[model samples]
Target: MNDFSKTDRLMERGSAFLGSRYAILCGAMSWVSERHLVSAISNAGGFGVIACGAMTPEQLETEIAATQELTDKPFGVNLITMHPQLFDLIEVCDKAGVSHVVLAGGIPPKGSVEAIKGGQNPAKVICFAPTLALAKKLLRSGADALVIEGMEAGGHIGPVSTSVLAQEMLPELSQDHIIFVAGGIGRGNAMAGYLEMGAAGVQLGTRFACAKESIAHENFKKAFFRANARDAVASVQVDARLPVIPVRALKNKGTEEFTQKQREVAGVLDRNEIAMEEAQLQIEHYWAGALRRAVIDGDVENGSLMAGQSVGMVKEEEPAADIIAKLMTQSEDALTRR
Candidate 1:
């Protein structure tokens, strides 16, 4: 491996935490982040997280085993906090001896962290904190690290932009805790700025979703190659009371369809056909299914083309190793120029 002294220096804390050569993490994208891409990222010296999106414990176990077969390097598992079988999935990770667990989609429902950390082999718990206060609270709540993703990211996102979240959260928590800044990060210079601001590392989703190793469909990758920043738009909340989190994706018939789906779910919610938790899960399930359609089934026009604003930077298919090397080289060059 080439010496990236400056970049490595800045990434020291995060690298140590993730047990990877670089602090870069591949943001877990449902179908795209399966064994192939995840192992490729880890083999490339960056951390790869398995997206255990809506997967049952048995499935997560099989994925973990498959990923381990591909790479001995460390990686993490991203589990949805709201998954009905959250604890069972945690057990699968525990049995697999996974190193890190990222809890996303909401606050770690009480004891979820404990359950993750309590196994014979404890895993570091990484949580998503959208705000400064929540960052502190998660840190205090036994979270080993935090990823502050902004609205600029693909899929479900918070209201703030990456720049704003970095300025707000990095200085406050980065000194004493491990914090990874994500969202709208497409290049190395942007990464350099965050490291200078005390970010432990960075996470990127859209940038890697179409890597040569990713299993995303050809149509899905083509849509990303053809898209611009403006093409990636966030879905509008059809009803405020439904507790729907806005999703960012490429505009298509599916985008409009989601609004209608939300309305339909809201009607069910209104009629008390399902409880609030069930309603929320219904919406999440919709996204998972839609994403699979685009990523796995090549239904880009009707499936959810979840992408970050960085989609504009993805020019073509490249090996994961080349991608990591390029980003690290660029980051090092930027640091040196400074």
Candidate 2:
């Protein structure tokens, strides 16, 4: 039987978040957190979140159904708030009986939140907030909980790191409002550490990206396996005037290419050769297609391989179940050692 005294604070919080066995959560990752991966994580006793970026409402419905077919356990659908079909996606999720819906990429639009909260079959709405103010705003605007994401997280990140966000927000937010910590969280020990810091649970994205059940391309996973802690750094401008979102990633062909392109674009804008809007559009398009090629086609060298700094810690691919179990074991071990 599992030992309760050996349970770490994070494990206890995670158990409370899930309201059942296990304190692990499979983070919602773009292009990779599909039905199979979500179901795999959930069935293994962790909360799995399906990333619904750029998907049409109809597409989300099919994916949600596919996930349901794979597991009867609770799972969540992650919606990109900036997506044009955000409202429709919420409708689809409501119809699918999705237990939880996480809104990422900016604060959730009020209309979307109202719809989700007011619907006859309303689902729990979870959103990511960068600061305590944002977290308070989300909760006031109908969010059931918040996933406090730090700059160290993969994909689009906020200005603050998870450490600061947690320190700033957790102290103010009431315990009734669930707060899950995200960014640079990979192992069970890390999860326990956050729990001690007052997080209800930890959301992990990068480590799962390399899991055997993950849909991330083989080359993408290989890059993560090859990464070292030193290899993962946030992007910086080549010139003082030009800056981009501080995305943390492994230094590889894709990252280098993106940085070089940013430098060139900044040069053009500084010289008034290109409009700021035009330069921004070009950068956005480049990243859009680049991420698709890397995630969908497995072209790691040219595609945007988004990952968290914790990626350097990932050495190999294992089944989602094994990863979850190992994390729990590690958390237990950490508690005993303490």
Candidate 3:
């Protein structure tokens, strides 16, 4: 059994892994993890990762430089490996001197990993894996660390739940590699709990989405505040197939619309009516524009208001700095009490 009660041991190891005051990482959220939020979290003592979902190389370079100007604190940029501009995004990170680069979405290509870890680009590469096998593969492929994100995470979740993944992957992975756990992590106690469970750090997205400094639309924040655990459920029954990307969100019009669209797309396969390429393109297009409608335009009803189950615990919109401070303080308090 691991001796989790050693505070010094935990802090030293945690800091080495997370490079932050608290072992908490703000998950890279597309459209939401822009300059303000990223800088705010990093300045507040937690690792903030900027999400680079659909940005061109030039855009990513501009964003990385902008984030650096905001704070000298260490921060990271997230890239979806499947994105068409994956190589370009990696080059941007290399040029911008980004301390860390988080690769999310799909299996990272070998060339992409080599580019990130190759000489001259010392940026720590982090990848999200749902299983021990995948984690091992990523580690072997030059990933500096792994983010074991569970199914409870919002926005493109893996097939496995966090509870199961943590239990299964943490023990098998070598201690040399870092492990950050994600999915439904909200409070400081939650962070401490995961650390006790062998997680080097915890990644939080939904909680930060409700922060005052977050760019999410007011209506979107309100929806999170209104949601309870019961209100936050995955859409499994709607699609029970493997490789099902679990999405934990509040039951709303936008979610219903997405489900309906998925069903409609699935039904038209027999007649060769909807090409897989076209269907995927439409879904991607729908989400690409949908989040902006809710986040920027404040149109919650017909927009994608992606949030995790932890949203129920978020009551008010507080400053990002305050949120970070409170979480660290709370985690310390919880650890001391234990």
What TM-score against the true fold does each predicted structure earn? Answer: 0.99, 0.87, 0.90
Candidate 1 stretches with Cα past 4 Å from truth are none
Lowest-sum lDDT 10-residue window in model 2: 4-13
- Per lDDT, the best of the predicted structures is 1
Candidate 2's TM-score reads 0.87
Clashing pairs in 1: none
Who is ahead in TM-score, 1 or 3? Answer: 1
What is candidate 2's lDDT per residue for 80-111, written digit by digit as tens?
77676688888898888887888876767769
**Candidate 2 lDDT for residue 294:** 84
**Candidate 3 C-alpha error for residue 313, in Å:** 0.7
Q: What is the C-alpha lDDT of each candidate?
A: 0.94, 0.78, 0.78
* lDDT by residue (tens digit), candidate 3, 211-302: 88788878888888888867776755354421235566667788788788777666665457866655655566667687788887888888
Best by TM-score: 1
Candidate RMSDs in order: 0.7, 3.3, 3.6
lDDT of 2: 0.78
Tens-place lDDT per residue, model 1, 1-338, is: 57699989999999999999999999999999999999999999999999999999999999999999999999999999999999899999999999999999999999999998999899999999998988888988999999999899999998999998999888778899999999999998899889999999999999999999999999999999999999999999888888788899999999999999999999998898899899899999999999999999999989999999999999999999898988898898999999
